[model samples]
Target: MRALIAIDWGTSSLRGARLSVTGQVLESREFARGILTVPPGQFEAVFNELFGDWMAAPHALCLISGMAGSRQGWQEAPYCPCPAGFAELGQHLLWLQADRIALVPGLSCMNPDTLNTPDVMRGEEVQLFGALQLAERNTATLVLPGTHSKWVQVEHGRVTRFSTFMTGEVYALLSQHSILGKTLDLNGTFDETAFLQGVDQSQQAGSVLNKVFAVRTLGLFERLSAAVLPSYLSGLLIGEELRHQNVPPAQGPVILIGSDALTLRYTLALRHLGIACQSRGAEATWAGLHALATKLTNKP
Candidate 1:
C-alpha cells in the first residue's frame, strides 16, 4: 500500500506523480522528453532524473502508462483487446526492471466502421479508466481531446468501443501548412463569437473541405479578423468531428477529460450543438494508475 510512482509518458511529454494508496498525489513533475525524445535504453535514466528525488526506497513501484509501453518505448507492452477493464489491464501489465516497474498495456478494438481494421490507444486508456471512475458511471461516452481526439464508449465498467478523430492534427496542418496557413495568426486570441459562428456554420450544408475556404474569404472581406480566425477554425473542425460522430444528444453529458484549453473549445462546441458535457482534470490519469497499482500489489 506504499505510494506508487505513476507516469503518463506520451509522444510529446512525460507527466509523473507520486500517489498514496488512497490515490492522493503527494508530488508531481513534468518533463519535455517524451518517448520520441528518450534515447534508446535511457528511459530509466530519464525517469530517474525527473523523479529520483521521490524514489524514497527500492520497494516503491513505478507504474507507467502511455507511449512508454509503445514499440519504440522502453518496452513493447502488447495491446489488450477490448472489452477491457482494470482486471484485464492488470492481467497484462508488463514488468520492466523486475517487479519494481511496470507498463500498462494499451487497448485495441476493431474499428466500428471497418469491422476488421484495428484501432489502438496507449496512454488514453488510463485516462478513460480514471474518467470512468471519477464519473462513477458504469456506462457513458467519454471524449478526450488533443492532437488526436477520442470518443470512447464504456459499458458495465469495460470499454466497449471507441473512435479517434484527427481534429487537432487537421487544424494544425491546415493552419500551418495548407493554403489557409497564410492568413492565420498563431498568436491571436480566442474569439467566442467567431468560434460560435464556425460552429453554426458546421451545422449548415457544405463539406468541411469546402467550408474552410471561407476563412480566406472572410479574412479577405475583413469580416473575420486574424485574431479570431483561429478560434473559428477550431470550432469548424471540432464541430465537424462531432457532427460526423453523430453521437445522439440522449447519451447524456459526455464526460470530457483533458487540458482546460482543449476541453474548453470542445465544451463550447458541444454545448452550442445542444449536447450535455461534464469535465474532469488530467488527474484522472493518476487516479487510474493508482487503481491499477493497487490491483497489482494486492494480487497473489
Candidate 2:
C-alpha cells in the first residue's frame, strides 16, 4: 500500500494520521472540527484545511471512519450488515475520489437482547478490527465504552453480533438534569471506595431503577458524601452494564477500546466483578484503517 492517511471523524472531534507502509503512524493531528461542527458541504474544505498537506503525498489513500459517513456527515456511506470483516468493509467503501479516498462503512447487526432491535456502530467497527489485529486473535468479546457503549462478539474475525448501552448518557442526564443532580458534588475527584460500594450494591438482587433512587436518598441522608456520589453513580451504571453480559469464561479477556478515562473505569468495574479484561485506545483506529487499506491494496 502507498502512504495511507487514516481519519477518525466522530461527533465532537476529528483525528488524522499519516502512516508508514508498515502501518506505524508517522504523523498525526486532531481538531475539534467534527461533522457536527462542520457546515453542510464544507467537509471537504475543512478536511483540506486541516490535512491538505498530508493528502499531497503522491498516491496517498485516505479511509475515513466514524460519523463523517452519517446522513448529516460528509457523505452517507450505507452501512454494511454483519457479519462483516475487512473484505466486506473494503467492498462497501463509499469512494469520494475513485481510489484516492473513501469512507469505511460502519457495521449493523440485530440486537442479541430481547426485542431484537437493529444495532449499529460507525467508528467503532474500525476499532474492533484494529483491536482484533492488535490482539492477534480471531474470536473475542469486545466492549467500547462511551456515550453509547457497545458489547461486540466476534467469530473467526468477523463481527457476528453486538449490543449497545446508554450508560454514559444516562449518567449525564441523571447527574446533570434529573432530580439526583440536586445534591451531586459534580466537581470532585473519583472516590474508589464509593465507586466500589456502588458496584457492590449493584450486584444485589434488585432492579437498577430501584437502586438509582438510592443515589438521591444516600445524599439526602448524608450517608454518602455529595462529592463522591458521582463516582458512586458511575459505578452503579457501569456495574449494571457488566452484570448483563453473558461473557463465557473461555472467550479470553474482554477487549476494551476507548479513551483512558473511560477504559480505566471499565477496567476497575470488570476487575471488581472478577472478570478479566484488556484495553486499547486511539491506536486501534489507525491500525484498523491501516489494515483495511492493506487489504484493499492486496485484493486480487
Candidate 3:
C-alpha cells in the first residue's frame, strides 16, 4: 500500500488526494459536503459512489479533517485541549473505523469559570500545521479567511493558542440573508481606498464594535450606500484585527490560507496597517491533506 491519503471534507465540499510515500496530491477534487446531499445512513455509500469512480485501491489509510468529524459527518471526533503537543495528539487520537481511518482532532480552549466563552475550531488547525510543515518551523502564526475566520499560533509543533472571528459569516448574513442583501454582493476585487478608510477608522479610539450598527443606520439615513456596506463591514473587521489583535511582528511568520479574493482582502488589510506579511502554500486544503496523510503513515 502507498501508506496515506488525505481527506478534507468540509461543510460544503469533499476533497481527497492519493499520495505516494512522499506527500503529493495524486488526485484531489471537490464534491458535495452537505449532509442533506449525501444523507446520514448512506455516507459511505455516497463517498464510495463519488470517489469510487477513480479509486485504484482503498487508500492504505486516510486521515480526514473538518466537518467530516462533526455530528453530521461520518463520525464525531473529540476536541483536544490546547498546549497540545505532538505526543499528546499521538496518544489522544480518535479512530472512526478501526486503524484504517482516523481523524485529527479539532482543538478547544477556555477560561473555566470567569468567561464561560470557549474558543472552538474545526478544520483550520490541520491547515495551520501544514503551513508549519512547509515553513519547517517550530513556531508560526497563520490566518485563514472565510465565514468564520481563524488566527492560530503554534509553538514547538503544538497549537498553543488561537482565536476566531465571525467576520465572514457576519458579512454573508447581513449582506445576503439580512435586509442589506439588496445592496451589495461584494464579488469585486478588494478596494484599496475603502479598506484603508476602514483601517483609519479602527485607530481613531472609540470601541470599533459600536460601528456595526452604522451599516444599517447609514443605509437608512442615505449616509452610506447599501451596496458598499459589505465592503465596509469587511474593512471594519479586518481593521480591528490589524489594530487590536495583540500579535507582534517578531512572532515568527504569518501564513494566510483562503481563496485568492479573501486573501487579497487580508493582504490589503495588512498593508493598510503597515504589518509585514507573507503568503504561504498556494493550495492549503491539498497541502493540508498531504500533511495528514504523511503524519499518519510516519506514525509507528
Candidate 4:
C-alpha cells in the first residue's frame, strides 16, 4: 500500500495530509495561502515548498480536492454533474506535472428548489462522500455549514442533489458592515437565550428584511443589549436559512459536518427547529480522499 498525499485546497487556505494506505494520517501540513492568493503558474512552487520534504518517492500519489481545481485555481478540473460517485469523479481527475499529482473534480446539480439554476460544490463533495462512508448509510441528508453552507441529499451512494446557502457570509457582512454593526458588540459572550429568541423570531410572520431591522431597533430600544446582538444576529441568519431552505424533517438525524464552532450553532438551530441532527468532525474529508485514492489506484 503506497502512502498518499491528500490536499484540501480552498479559497483562503490549504491543508495537506500524508496518509498510510489504510487512511491513517501519518503527517499533516497547512498553509495560509489559498488559490486566490497563489500567483498564476506558482501552484507547483507553493506545493513543493509545502510538501517537498515528504514527497518521498517519484510514484507517490498526490490527490487534491477543492478550489485548486476551479477555473481560477491551479488547473480547472471541470465539474462532474450530479448523480456522481467516486467512480464518476475518478474518471475526471486532472493530472498535473506528469501523472503524479491529480486534482479532483467538483460536483454540480440542477437546483431542485430553484428552476433552471444550477448549484455546484468543490471540496465538499469529498467530505460528503466521506460522510456517506463513515455513516454507512444508503440515504442521508448532509448539512455542511460554512461561508456558503450546503444542504446535500445522497441516495444509493451517489449525490443526487444539493443546495447552497450564503448564511455565514451574509452574517459576517451584516455584523461587520451594516447599520446593525453600529450598535452591536461582536466580542460579547454567546448568549443561547438571545440566540434562540432570534431562531424563534425567524418563524414569525414577516419578511426577513423586516425582521433584521429589529436587530437595530431592539438594540436602540435597549430591549436587546449590544453584548448579545452578535449571537442574536447569528441565530436569526441561521434560522432564516433553515426556514427558507426547507430543511426536511429528519428521516434520520441530519449529518452535520464541519468545525466545532459552526456545527455547534447549526446543531442548536436544527434542534430548535425540531430537526434531529448529529455532529461529525471534518475528518470526513480524509476518509473521502482515501476512498477516491483507492478507487483511482485500483483502476486499470
Candidate 5:
C-alpha cells in the first residue's frame, strides 16, 4: 500500500504524519521549525531527521502546507485564488524534490493591484476542507484562530473568500511585548463587562488599538482585572468581525477550529452578538494532514 505523508510546517514547528490511503494514521512526529531556532539553512536535514524512520517505507507521496513552502523552505509556491476547491490546491503544487514530494500553495485573497492588500493562508486550507467534510455539506463557515485569525467561508466544497483579523498577534504584541505589555497582569482573565465596553469602543473608533489600553486602565483603577482580559479581547475581535456583516448570512452556524480556550472565547462573543457559534475544537492537524495527503495521492 502506498503511504501518504502530510506536513503542516508552520512558523515555529513542523508536524508530519503518515497515513493509509483510507486516511488512517500510521505514524506522526513533530520537529522544531523556527527558521531561526533550527539549523541556519538545513530544513531538509531537520525534516529528514524528524521523519527518517517513517521515510524508509513503501511508495511515498508527500503534500506539505504552511511555512515549508515559504521563502525559506524547500520552495515557495504561489497562492491560489479564492473560490478554490480540492483540485484548486492541485494547481498550486510546488515540487519539493520529485514525484515523492509536493507542497500545496497557500490561499490568497484581495486584489493585489492598486495595493488594495492581500491575505494568504497556508496550512488552514486542509482544516477548512476537513471541517466541511465532517459537515458533509455544500456550504460551511469556519473560523481558524491563531496568531492571525481568519474567518473562512466555504461553499460548494470550495473556499470562496475570507477575512483575516490580526487580532491575536496584535493582542500578543500589545499585551506582552510592547510598551503596553508592561501594564498587563500575569494572571489576568477575561472581563465580560469590559469586553462589551471595549467592543463598543473598538466599533466606534478609528484604529482597533485606539482604546485597547482602557482595559488596563479600568483594571488599575480597581474597576477591573482577570475576568476582563478575555472578554475585552473577545469584544475587540467581535467588533472587528461585525464589520464584515454588511449583509448577514441567513444566520447559519459558525464552526470554530482551534485551541479550546480561544475558540470558546470566540463562541462566547458571537453568542453575545446573538449569533450562534459552535466550537469544533482544534481540527486534528495530523488528521487534516492525512486528508490532504490522501487527496493528493488520488487514493481511495
Candidate 6:
C-alpha cells in the first residue's frame, strides 16, 4: 500500500491525514477551510495549497470524504445507497485523478419510521466504518452526536439502517432564538445534576414540546439557577434522543464515535439509562479511510 492522504472535509472545517502503508496516521492537519469557505471552483487549488506537499510523497494516494463530494461541494459524488461497506464506497469513489485522487461517497437510506422517507449522511459514514474497525465488530449499534446526531445499526460489515435526530440543532435554536434563550446561560459549565434532572424528566410520559417550556418556568420560579439551565435543557434534548432508541442489554455495548465534548454528554446519558457503551474519536476517520484504501489495493 502507498502512503495515503485521507481527508475529512465538512461544511465548517477540513481535516487531513498522511498515513503509512500499514494504515497508521503518520501526520495530520486541520483547517477552517471547509467547502463553505472555498470560492467557486477553487477546491482543487485550495486542496493543493493546504496539502500539496503531502501529495508530493512518492506513490501517495488521496481519498476525500464528506461534503467535498456533495452537489454544493467540489464535485457531486452521488450517494452510495445503504447496506454499504468499504467495497461499495471504494467502487463509487469519484476520482479527481484516475488511480490517484478521489472522493469517498456518502450513504443514503429510506427510513421506515418516517413512512419510508429518505435519510443520508456525508462524513459520518467514514467514522462509522472506522468505529467498526476499532471495535473489531461487524455488527453493533453506533451513535455519533453533533448538530445532527446519528443512531446507526451495522450488520455483517454493512450499515443496514440509521436515523438522524435534530437534537443539537434544535438545542441551538431554542437556546438562542426561542424564549428559552432568555433564561439559559449558554456559557455555563456542564451541570450534571441539572442535566440528569432533565434526563429524568424526559423519561416521564409527556411531549417534549410541553417539557421544554419548563426551562422558563424553572427559572421564573427560581427553582434552578440561570447558570445551569442550559445543562438542564441539554439533558432534555439528549434524553429525548435516547428515549427513542431500543438498545436492549443483549445487543452489546453501544459504540460512540465523535469528539470528546459531544460524546461526553452521550456517555453520561447512556450510562444513566443503564446501557453500557464505549467511545472512539478522530482516529476512526483515519482508520475508515485506511480500510477503504486497503480494499482498493487488494481488489483484483
Ranking by lDDT: 2, 6, 4, 1, 5, 3
Q: In model 4, where is the ten-residue run with the lowest total lDDT?
A: 244-253
Model 3 agreement with the true structure over 1-300: per-residue lDDT tens digits: 345667777788777776666676676667766554667778778767776554446556767778777777777788888877556555555786677667777788773443656888877877777767776776777788788888887777888777788878776776668655655546655556656666677667788557655666766787656556667777876777666566667875467887788888887888666665666644565565566555555777
lDDT against the true structure, per candidate, is 0.88, 0.93, 0.70, 0.89, 0.70, 0.93
Error of 4 at 170 (Å): 0.6
**TM-score ranking of the models:** 6, 2, 4, 1, 3, 5
Of the pair 3 and 6, which is ahead by lDDT?
Answer: 6
Clashing pairs in 6: none
Residue-wise C-alpha lDDT for candidate 1, range 113-189, written one tens digit per residue: 87678888999999988888877876888999988899998888899888888889999999999888777787998
List the candidate 3 regions with Cα displacement exceeding 4 Å. 53-59, 111-116, 177-189, 216-227
- Per-model tally of clashing residue pairs: 0, 0, 0, 0, 8, 0
- What is the TM-score (0 to 1) of candidate 6? 0.98
Task: Quantify how close model 3 is to the true structure by its C-alpha RMSD in Å.
Answer: 2.9
Q: How many pairs of residues in model 2 come into backbone collision? A: 0
| lDDT for position 206 in model 2 | 93
TM-score of structure candidate 2: 0.98
Model 6, span 169-253: residue lDDT tens: 9999999999999987888999999999999998889899999999999999999999999999999999999999998577689
Please list the residue runs of candidate 2 whose C-alpha ends up more than 4 Å from where it truly belongs after superposition.
Answer: none
> What TM-score does structure 5 among the candidates reach?
0.85
What is candidate 4's lDDT per residue for 49-86, written digit by digit as tens?
Answer: 88987786657988999999999999999999988877
Give model 4's TM-score versus the native structure.
Answer: 0.96
Better of 4 and 6 by lDDT: 6
Our model 2 lands, by Cα RMSD against the true structure, at 0.9
For candidate 5, the C-alpha RMSD (Å) to the true structure equals: 3.1
lDDT, residue 100, candidate 4: 78
Q: Tell me the TM-score of each prediction against the true structure.
A: 0.95, 0.98, 0.86, 0.96, 0.85, 0.98
Model 6: per-residue Cα lDDT at residue 15: 97
